[model samples]
Target: MRGTAAADRQSRPGRRALVAADLSMLRGPVSGVVVLPNRLVWAPAPAGRFDLDDPFDRLRVYEIVLREAVHEAELRRWLNGAVLVEVWPHLYLPRGVRQAWEAIHPQLAVVPAR
Candidate 1:
């Protein structure tokens, strides 16, 4: 599925400011989560998939997954065939999810990995 609302929301000023503020929280170039207008983008490998051999080839798949046990089916109708995970919400490690957390709180986010 395409993220039209995501593209549109990025252009707005208030949302842009929020994005900027969120971006500022990052220590350096990283692969984690980005909260856009209506969607969430997760980048697991910020280094751009070092596991790949060809650099130019290989799918830098973000997976757009949710591993949490409870909110699996109830989360989304638009997202089908997406990965799912089960993790304790507040007690989880601070990876890139911190940024996503701010944007989504208890709601599941649609992270767009680049």
Candidate 2:
């Protein structure tokens, strides 16, 4: 019965890594300078705020949130849908994190032209 249950789960579609509940929940600022709380983004290095207008800053924010965020609210607070979609192809996320997000949002897989 345990084997059968495992097989059933595997057969189901849309199964993915345990990341955010959904990417659509991301409703953060699209353009602006924002400072993330230490609880969400903290390191041994000096404090550095992320400027959404800058690609590098945006990418860094996404990377940290995707990897270290412990709750969905954290993602929702710092990730905007428009910005996330635009930066999705460029973000260097872990395999599971990337797979989880891409599974729900296949459009993210489409890399934009440089």
Give the C-alpha lDDT of model 1.
0.26
Clashes of each: 13, 0
lDDT of 1 by residue, 1-109 (tens): 1111222222223331112122212232122333221233334434323222222211122222221211222124212221211122222323443343335333334
- lDDT at residue 90 of model 1 (Cα atoms): 23
Evaluate model 1: give its TM-score.
0.17
Candidate that would win on lDDT: 2
* Candidate 2 structure quality by residue, lDDT tens digits, 1-114: 000111112211443233444566678887788777777566533454888788888888888776666556767787777778778878877666776666656778785845
Lowest summed-lDDT stretch of 10 residues in model 1?
16-25
TM-score to true structure, per model: 0.17, 0.72
Reference-based lDDT, residue 39, model 1: 33
Instruction: State the C-alpha lDDT per candidate.
Output: 0.26, 0.65
